[model samples]
Target: MHKILVTGGAGFIGSNLSEELLRRNYKVRCLDNFATGHFKNIESLLANPNFELIVGDIRNIEDCQKAVDGVDYVLHEAALGSVPRSIKDPIMSNSVNVGGFLNMLVASRDAKVKRFIYAASSSTYGDSKTLPKVEDVIGKPLSPYAITKYVNELYADVFSKTYGLECIGLRYFNVFGRRQDPNGAYAAVIPLFVKQFMNHESPVINGDGEYSRDFTYVDNVIQMNILAMTTSNSDALNTVYNTAYGERTTLNQLVHSLKEILAEFDPEIGNVDIKYGSNRAGDIPHSLASIDKAKNLLGYNPEYSLRKGLEEAIKWYWENI
Candidate 1:
């Protein structure tokens, strides 16, 4: 039995991963400060005896060491995510994403954890005008958040080489699903759009709506994480893989799909208006991933396309909110 330590386990992506691990009967320990995570996400998991919650912040070295003490694998997902937020407060984002991440790495290494898998970000692709972003080719980081994520990959590589720590970084694209918060100013586009549509409020598109993204579903991300943690291939151990669905959808297409799906539950949603604003700073014009490396190395097979993922996500939102 593997004892896995999931940092930020109360947050959207972390909570989803933790739930799936528990379903598979793994002993899971969740370390969260709840800075952005909601208690409602993990409230049910607390009842399970296999679940252990450590109310701690990863920024503190002692807290990180405590969390990794007896863990077999460390899933480092604790970070302040959002380009705008990082732009607003680079110091704070650095403290959490970079400073805290370093603490976790040191702690995991010291604890002799078998494998360390951490969340990387697509923002690392930055100003590169590439059609399908690859793992090796990258551009200059555009924002503080992108810089921090790029730093994470660099640190992971150095740790693997210098300390012999087995590490894998999963460079996630725009991931969305249940438990993703839709209220905050920094909320993701998909869930945020769904929430606005549910309320019959107009969703604000940042540009002319042609800007595209490889909006990945969270389940696909979970599959990538699991594969990264358990793979027997030595070549796959100390590298980063792009965790995405390998397709692109424009913001206009995304909005249309959301309205169509939500309209099934409430017809009036289709009538809701969409408003366009100036292109946001630090936002790329488009993003797409080349998943060939993940497929060849980790045997990655994505189960949901954007349409299928949007349907399930809309259903969950309708039922929960």
Candidate 2:
């Protein structure tokens, strides 16, 4: 059995990846500092013998080294993720996203890990008006968070060339699904809207409600990671792939869909109103991904669309929250 180390494995996406890895019978070691991750996310997996939790921060090289020791693969997901938060505090974001990322790369190289796959962000496609963002074309970063993620790609490339470490970066577009926190200040749009609708409060739209995104489901992201880790095609290595559902949903359409889905559980939720606000800084008008590379290279067939994934997410939130 392969022993895989998942950094930030207690976070929403990390926890999901760890759970699926364990389900597939891979020995999973989770390293998290609980900075932004909650124990409850991984609470259910504790009893599984194949699952191990390491309480450590990726910012610390020693912690990173310990996590990568004897691990066949490293899924580096431990980064401070939020464009607005990064804008508020770029130093902390850089420390974890960039500095911590470098630590993981070095540790993985030293450990001689088979492969290192990481959670890159679509935010790396900042300030580009390009529709259906392809892998090679990129624009100047619009936020500190974008800069950090872009830097991750650059660092991975250098590591791959210099130390012969195998690295793959999955640039996740607006990922949403179960266990995604909806209560935080930096809560993503889908969950946040669901939470507000559940509470019968008005969910706010940041712009004129035309901002669109290739909102990917978490399952697709997990599939990408697995493919990246296990692919035998040498040509697929040491590069980034846009992990998304390859469709755009405007904020207006998104809220309408959420209301329609959530209304099934509570008819009252459908009555909830939506408010409009000024556009957020560092936010582009529209964001979409071209998943052709991932589909062709990794055989990535995404299982969920926005409505489908939202249904699953709403079900989980209804049951748990």
Candidate 3:
């Protein structure tokens, strides 16, 4: 069995990926600092013999190096996520997302890992008004968070070209599902809305509630990461793919849907109030993804739609969170 090291494996997407890896009989080592990630995410897997957990900061080269040792592949997911968080503190975002990514790249290169598959973001699409975002085309980044994620692709490309390190980036669009924290200020919109409505609190929709996103489920992300780590095509090795279900959902529509879904849990929650706030700084109007590259190249096929994904996500949030 191949050994894979998953950074930030205690977080939402990372934890799910780690569980899938373990399910497939991979020797897994999970490295995380628990900054935004919670230990509860990985608590169930602690008894697994093939899984190992290392609580450490990715910003530390020693931790990165130690985590990569003898690992056949690296799924780099550690980062300071959220555009609003970045705007509030660009330095922290840059240091962790960008600086920490470079540290992992150098460490993985030196460790001679099979491939480096890092988490890129849809935020990198920024101000590009394109209906469905393509991998080859993108506009200037809108937030410090987007800039950091963009820089990740740049660094991975440079590493592959300069040092012969194979890297593939997956630009995930609005991923939300199990293990996603809904309490924090930097929480993703879907989970935040679900939690607020469950608690009878009015969820705030930034902008006019018209800002849309290609809301992807986390399982599709897990599939793409597996494919990326295993594929050997030279053409596909260095390029990035849009890891999404190729659909868009507006915040207004999203809130209404969440309320409707949560109604099954408590009918009273069906009438959850919504408050519209002024447009946030460093915000984009629309985000839609073109998953064609991922489809043609990686054999990637997303199996969940927004409603389907939110159904499971809402159930998990109501039960665990």
Candidate 4:
């Protein structure tokens, strides 16, 4: 059986990917520092015989080397996310996102892993007014976080060419699902809105509610990662693919859908009001992904639409939160 190392495997996306990997009977080793990840996210997987947890930070090259040792594949997911947070502290973000990412690439190359898959960001498409963002076209990064993710792609490319390390980057677009923390200052919109609506508080929209996103579900992301890791096609290697549902939902439509979905569990949630505020800095007006590359190359067929994924997410939040 193939053994895979997942960095930041205690975070929301990391934990979910680890769980799915374990379910598929892959030997999984999880490395996390708990900087932004929580143990509770991976608590249930501790008892699994195939699952191992390494308490370490990707910022440390030693930790990265240890995690990649004896691993066939590496999934690098450790990074400080959030544009505002990066804006507030670009140094720390750079240290973890860019510095830590370089560490992983080096470790993975040295370990001679079969493949290295990583979480790229749609924010890399920053400041571009292009609709249905294709892979090759990009604009100047709008924030430090965007710059860091874009740098990851460049570093991975260099590593692939220089060291002959096989690498694939999955550019995630607004991923959300079970275990997404809703209480943090940098909480994503879907979970944050669900938490506020559950508490009967007004959920705020940052703009005039016209900002749209290709809000991908976590399952689709997992599928993309697996495909990236296991694909035998040589042409698909050493590149990036957009991991999205290929559909857009406006903030207004999103709130309305959230209310409609949550109302089923508690009718009172339906009446919760939404408030609008000034647009957030570093945010694009519209964000959508063209998943044709992923579909054609990786056979990526996203299983969840926005509503479908939201339903699953709400169910998990309702029971857990």
Error of 3 at 85 (Å): 0.8
lDDT of 2 by residue, 1-321 (tens): 999999999999999999999999999999999988999999999999999999998888999999999999999899999999999999999999999999999999999999999999899888888999999999899999999999999999999999999999999999999999998899999899999999999999998999899998899899999999999999899999999999999999999999999999999998898999999999978899999999998888999998899999999999999
TM-score of 1: 0.99
CA displacement after TM-score superposition, residue 35 of candidate 3 (Å) = 0.7
- Evaluated against the true structure, the overall lDDT of model 3 is 0.92
Question: Model-by-model lDDT, in order?
Answer: 0.95, 0.94, 0.92, 0.95
What's the C-alpha lDDT at position 46 in model 1?
Answer: 97
Which should have the higher TM-score, number 2 or number 3?
A: 2
- Give the Å shift of residue 181 in candidate 2: 0.4
Model 1 C-alpha lDDT per residue in residues 1-321, reported as the tens digit of each score: 899999999999999999999999999999999999888999999999999999999899999999999899999888999999999999999999999999999999999999999999999999999879999988999999999999999999999999999999999999999899988889999989999999999999998999999999999999999999999999888999999999999999999999999999999998999999999999988999999999999999999999999998999999998
lDDT of 4 by residue, 1-321 (tens): 999999999999999999999999999999999988999999999999999999998888999999999999999899999999999999999999999999999988888999999999999999888999999999999999999999999999999999999999999999999999998799999999999999999999998999899999999999999999999999899999999999999999999999999999999998888999999999978999999999888888999999999999999999999
Order by lDDT, highest first: 1, 4, 2, 3
Judging by lDDT, tell me the better candidate of 3 and 4: 4
- At residue 64, what lDDT does model 4 achieve? 92
Per-model TM values vs. the true structure:
0.99, 0.99, 0.98, 0.99
Off by over 4 Å in 1: none
Residue 85 in candidate 4, Cα distance off native in Å:
0.5
